[model samples]
Target: MIKILICFSVIFSSGIGLNLYATHHQPVNESNALDLAANSKSAILIERDTGEVLFNKNAQEVLPPASMTKIMTLLLVMEELENGKLQLSEKVRISEKAASMGGSQIFLEPGEEMTVNDLLKGVAVASGNDASVALAERIAGSEEAFVEMMNQRAKQLHLKNTLFQNPTGLPAENHYSTAEDMALLAKELLKYDEITKYTSIYEDYLRKGQENEFWLVNTNKLVKFYEGVDGLKTGFTNEAKYCLTATAEKDGMRVIAVVMGADSTKNRNSDVSAMLDYAYSKYTTKSLFDKNQQVTSFNWLKADQQKVNVITNDSISILHKKAEDLTGIETDVKIDQDISLPIKKGTAIGKLEVKKDGKVISETDLVIEEDMDKAGTFQLMGRILRSFLNK
Candidate 1:
């Protein structure tokens, strides 16, 4: 994660007078926002790109996550795929324990073989407990070891209100998480594009040719009915109640909404829908700068490269209330740091501060655009003599 330092200052710029340095940490005032009076026990809405919380209620209240815990399962699978430790075409032999899962499952029989791809589909679209456990065993050698990996990942992600007892989210003491924690997990899950391919499917057949073909219907109904709602998970257990972590993207903005411990499925859907609606209606995001764009150029005091261009490797997006005025926003570049000889191409030289109406909204590190070599010995001596003569 990139650490952003946000500080406010009043600055003057050409064409824009009295520019504002807007800090991204400033919370949006909720006075004029819609009254979410959501019925779910805990809920939150956040911008996917910026991780800004738009609305939340009791989001840290830990409760049974049910199958929503599978988001981490999917995340770990995606990571393994990216790292080449796992392949989609590889076959997994179902374990007797995995075949015995009781809750939502693909009904795998012991010793039956399935590809990692289909198992992913079963878990993502069908919420298959058997598939989840099978993949868990395949990834970490055993379900218990996989749970350890899951908890380790959660700790690395800084999730404070979470604990996992099983890969299928089966009801067990101490198996719980908060809405906020689940939303964060969903945010991480969305980073892998491969996930959406499976999660967005409304219905598909698992065993296409066999006589006992299993049809998989998405547990998340909103994927079929709600526009832009492609993914996430739904959970329900006698002890957990109804839970959902719904994510949607419209235009260029994406938002994640999580609802936990709702009294009914209707209430969960309604609350998650309301949160999405609030996010779309009240907030907006803009791509302020594209990745690798040269933001500015500066003189290199002692390097072989006479000049260095400050560049950004990641795109910068600003999120704000839809009603706020954006015309007066401006950016301020700060470069008080020293430049040394032999600077690397991606070395951080300074920072670009984005301001809205004179307050710092966001900031990104400015890096050296290209590699710089040290000045030759003769050139360094000549420059030293020239500097002394000039002085």
Candidate 2:
């Protein structure tokens, strides 16, 4: 076993692919081995579907996220929108405190009303401090309360290194996140398609046709310049420096890349672009099976139903490098010898493990696809008699 510790500043500028583990404890096939390094303080590139880290550099180093903190803010808004607690068409009355927020705003005035849709646009496109505070206050009744919610949600998401001091990514002591944490947040935000509707817009008008209509443009320029790039956030502050958490999809593969604490905008964009380019150029995503795809069937012990179908609870996909032959990869499905009665539809019977060159690459739970009820004593005896007679 070889441990390769990569320093990005030296090797990344040359565009060399580092044969780093796309994930820890799993080895890519020799043919698929590639090295990736990025010139940034902290960076990570992950496949969205599988959450595989194609490349990482100081990914766990906690740092101020600046406006990228709004990813969590957006996540909370998305949660409210998804649970039907908030509506896009519903109007939110701006508070004096919200309007008083500093840096990157749509210039919302106190007592002015804006729909949730427009407010989301302001946060996603303009990186609006005022808009973020308004939505935060609307959801949690106060920015401080909303920040509490953010921390709670972070805990739920198992993000240990993330903390939120404010909703709008303002520089504050003790408010910081790791690239890994921010990338995870970006992944959660992508679950809501409505977010992309605003993040993808290169330019649009807020309060259209009004006397004080504000022209909103996306702070993340990669939306226009990079192919397959759509929605994400960018950040910069004296403390946070230039940072971006970007996501893009191409040919069924979605990637999330985070670059934080860059020296300049050019450096930040370049580093993110390089990480994304490396991911797209080197990998291909392949789904092994769809959810409910039958793996095998087995007779149930002590069940009225004679057989239970085993299947995958969710689809499984793998990111293999272009040069590698997926056929070379091995899959072994390990299942229980006898499935017992009273089985639930999603009960895990065992697991399917994927290996490349003897190293475990991925694993998915194998589950019973349908419920199995226990059989009465008489019924079990009758079935046994029938089976014996047939044999």
TM values, all candidates: 0.76, 0.74
Candidate 2 TM-score to native: 0.74
Q: In candidate 2, how many Å is residue 88 off?
A: 0.8
Clashing pairs in 2: 17-35, 18-34, 18-35, 18-36, 19-35
Angstrom error at residue 151, model 2: 0.7
On residues 1-391, what C-alpha lDDT tens digit does candidate 1 reach at each position? 1222333333333222221222332224562254663678877777765566777677789899999989999999998997789999999999999999998999999999999999999999989999999999999999999999999999987899999998889899999999889988997788776688899999999889998799999989899888999999999999889999999989788889888888888778888887788778876777766767987775544667666677874456667666665554567767644455566777776777776555665667777778888778787788889889999
Model 1 lDDT on a 0 to 1 scale: 0.80
Candidate 2, 30-82: lDDT as tens digits: 32243433447888888875567877777889899999999999999998986
Instruction: Report the C-alpha displacement of residue 390, candidate 2, in angstroms.
Output: 19
Local error of candidate 2 at residue 140 (angstroms): 1.0
* Candidate 2 Cα lDDT to native: 0.80
Candidate 1 residue 103 C-alpha distance from true site, Å: 0.2
Model 1 ranges with Cα > 4 A deviation: 1-27, 31-34, 289-315, 327-391
